[model samples]
Target: MKFLDQAKVYIKAGNGGPGCVSFRREKYIEFGGPDGGDGGKGGDVYAEAVEGLNTLIDYRYQQHIKAKAGVHGMGRDRTGAGGADAVIKVPAGTQIIDAETEEELADLTEIGQRVLLARGGNGGFGNTHFKSSTNQAPRHANPGQTGEERTLILRLKLIADAGLVGLPNAGKSTFLSAVSKARPKIGDYPFTTIHPGLGVVHVDGREFILADIPGLIEGAHEGAGLGDTFLGHIERCRVLLHLVDGTSEEPLEAYNTVRGELEAYENGLAEKPEIIALSKCDSLDEELEDLQAEPIERATGKDVARISAISGKGMIPLLRQIADAIEADKAAERGKDARPEPAWQP
Candidate 1:
């Protein structure tokens, strides 16, 4: 199936039923009073998040959705029937936003989550409601209210525990394939990966999800190459694994280029915990690998790991480091949520 993360749709709720205006007539009765009934309510529009859906591609073909209108009221004090509701099913992690104002309406991160997009109109009142001592013979009735309409935007952001990022040909796909069962296309050319891919990584008898996104080039934030559109898939990751090509002539420049793009994106991605590694070390000698990692380590103020997916060198340590970082971040998040609320004060 084609992967679509964004979609635009229009929705409208049902209109309320109109009230009836009638007078009761009985045999041998000198005078008759009004006996009209109220109208039924309209149907509502709702958005529900469900599992087994990872893309918004379904909305691409269907753009407009509308609920059924309520039936009109009848004479003899008979009320109208209510309209049926319209429900939209979307994938988990889908966010609904206003198409024109870009205002966030709802965020569904879990399965079975639901939000009301548009409310139905209220039923109109009948002439019986207006009957009083001053006006015993009422003849007027209220009209049905109109339904609400809106244009919405649906954006999907994938949730994962770890994300792989770097420049083109930086061995991200190779690394992902080496660690998991996912088989992403690998080539020596740039932009081989046109979309984001997810994999399940098992380390230390524990499993966690990992994501690999398209590589970043210079001026990516300005729409240079593939842009940073795919970056949103990893915004929820706990940690990022940055793979710098060890065999590249200008390794430090390549490292800094990817880092610059991340900072420019400005989605708290730059501040996320990252583990820098010199990939494809099998092609480089021990002396050259040490020399290539020195500048990166000095600039980042942390030790740089060396790994070669082909030779399985440093594989254990790399997976261990990633797992450790993920566990630590999870712990910190739990602690933050467990913190007690401060005592209330004026």
Candidate 2:
């Protein structure tokens, strides 16, 4: 499926039915009073979050949504049928905003979460509604109201366990392909990855999702070199995989440059739980690996894991280490004081 993170749309609620303005015109019934019924309510428009979806591509083609209108009222004090409500299903983590004012409408975080956007108008009154004790034959009524319409924006942020970060051609795409089933375009040049890609890795009967974010460059926070656009996707990740290309002329410089961009864009991004990786180790000789990764580890105060994607050298150990770190982070997140009952107490 084509990935679409952000989209614009217009939604309209159904209008209410008009009130009835009929009178009893039967034989020998000259004293017929006002018999207009109340109008039906209009339909409402709601958006709900659902599972098994991670894109907003559907909204690109269909930018408008409208609810059913209510039925008109009838004579003999008969009310009209209410309009049918409209339900819209969207992917989780989709943020809704009002297009006119650019205000936030809703942030759909969990599955089945819903928010009503537009409300329909009330129905009009019939001529019989004006009947009074003094006036036996009333002849006045109100009309039905119109539904609400507004433009909205929907943007999706993919939730993941870990996110890959680096500069363009820093081997982030290569590393993800080697570890999981994702097939992102990889070349010897820069700016290859245009969007974020997700890969699922299973270890010990447990599956965790990882995201390969587009590479960052200097001044990325200021809209330079892919900007800080894809960084939002990593805000929810429990851990980050910061890859530094081992073949770079200055590996430590490459690491620090990306780190500066992260901190510039988001204050706490630099402080997130991260694992330092020295990619393309197979392309370098043993002596070069020492010069590339050891200095980087010392400079960044992180143990840089060296791995080769093509030859699969040291890939398993790297993945296992990542899984361990992830487990440890989750454990710490729950805190040590979290008490539980026996396993089979039930």
Candidate 3:
């Protein structure tokens, strides 16, 4: 299936049923009073996050979603039936935003999460409600109110524990394929992976999700070479795996270019814990690999791991490091959640 992360849609709630107006008639009765029943309520519109979905491509063709209208009122004090509700099912991590104001309405990150999009109009009153001592024979009935309608924007962001970043042909896809079962397209050219791909990585009896997005080029934040549009997929990652092509003429420059793009992008992506690695080290000897990694290590003041996805060199250590980082992050999050609340002051 083609991956679609964003879509625009219009939703409308159902209209309420109208009230009924009727007069009672009985044999041998001198006078009969009004006996009209109140109308039924309308159906609401809701958006729900469901499992087994990873894209918003289903909403591409269906732009408009509408609920069923309520049935009209009947005579003899009979009320109309309520309308059927409309439910929109979306993938987990889908965010609903108001198209006009660009304000976020709801962020669905878990399965079975639901949010109300529009409320149906209320049912109108019947003539019986107006019956009083002042007005003995009230003949008027109110009409049903109109339902609510609005346009919405749905954006999907992939949820992963770790993400891969680097320049084109830096071996991000190869690493993902080697580590997990995800079969992303691998090519020697730039932008081999157009869309973001996710995989489950298992290391030492531990498993975590991994995401790989398109490679970033110089000025990627400003619409350069595939742009930074795909960067949002990794915004939720706790750690980043940055791969620098060992065969490149200047690995430091390549690393700096990707770092610059990440810093330029929003959401504290640059501040995330990062693990740097020199990829395709199988093509280089030990001395040459060390020589290529020296500048990057010095620039970042961190030891760079030499890895080759094809030959599986340094793969275990790299996976172990990623697992450890993810575990640490998870522990930190649990600590934050477990913190005691401050005592209330009088």
Candidate 4:
């Protein structure tokens, strides 16, 4: 299936049914009263997050969604049937925003989560509601109210525990394929992986999701190369695995270029915990690998792991580090959610 992250759609709720005006008529009835029935309620519009879906491509063809209208009221004190509801099922981690104001209406992060996008109109009252001792022969009825309508924007962001970042052909896809079962397109050219891909990495009896997006180049934030459009896919990652090509002429410059784009994009990506690794270490000898990693280590103030995805060198250690970082982040989130007991109050 083709991946689609964003879509625009128009939604409308159902309209309520009108009331009926009638009077009872019999052969020998001396005092006959009004017996009009009330109208039925209209259908509602809802957006739900469901499983087995990862893209919004289905919304591309179907842009306008409308609910069913309620049935009209009947005479002889018989009410009309209510209309059926309309639901829009989307993938998890999808967000609904108002197209006009760009305000985020709802964020669905978990499966089975649902939100009411529009409410149906209320049913009108019948002539029997106006019947009283003074106005026994009421002949008036109210009309149904109109339904609500609006345009919305749907945006999807992939949820992952760790993300991979580097320059093109820096071995990000190779590392993902080696570590997990996800077999993304691998080639020697730039931008081999045009779209974002997810893999499940298992290390030391623990598993976590990993995301690999398209490579970034100089001025990527300014629409250079593939641009930073795919960067939003990794915004929810707890840690980043930054890979620097060991065979590149200037690895430090490549690393700095990607970092510049991340900082320029500025969505807390520059502040995320990162693990730097020199990829394709099998192509270089020990001395050459050390020489290539020295500048990046000095600039980042951290030790850089030498790894080769093809030969499986340093893969376990890298996976373990990513798992540890994910665990630490989860622990920190749990700590924040834990509320301390309050002191005794008067």
For each candidate, what TM-score against the reference? 0.92, 0.89, 0.96, 0.96
Q: Please report the candidate that would top TM-score against the real structure.
A: 3
Q: Per-residue CA lDDT of candidate 4, range 1-346, in tens? A: 8989999999998888888898888779888798888787788999999999989999999999888877777778877777788999999889899999999999999999999998887677778888999999899877777888999999998989999999999999999999999999999999999999999998899999999999999999999999999999989999999999999999999999999999999999999999999999999999999999999989989999999999998999989998999999999999988968889999
Task: Assess candidate 3 and give its TM-score to the true structure.
Answer: 0.96
Error of 2 at 151 (Å): 1.9
Of 3 and 4, the candidate ahead on TM-score is 3
Give the 10-residue window scoring lowest on summed lDDT in candidate 4: 71-80
Say which prediction, candidate 1 or candidate 2, comes out ahead on lDDT. 1
Per-prediction backbone clash count: 0, 3, 0, 0
Instruction: Assess the local accuracy of residue 27 in candidate 3 as a C-alpha lDDT between 0 and 100.
Output: 82
For candidate 1, list the clashing residue pairs, or say none.
Answer: none
Worst 10 residues of 1 by lDDT: 68-77
Model 4 misplaced stretches (Cα beyond 4 Å): 341-346
Candidate 1 Cα lDDT to native:
0.91
What tens-digit string does per-residue lDDT give for candidate 1 at 151-211?
Answer: 9999998878999999999999999999999999999999999888889999889888999
- Per-residue lDDT for 185-228 in model 2, tens only? 88878889989999998766667888998899999999998899
Clashing residue pairs in candidate 2 (N, C-alpha, C atoms within 3 angstroms): 34-128, 124-143, 127-140
Clashes of 1: 0
Residue 89 shift from truth in candidate 2, angstroms? 2.8
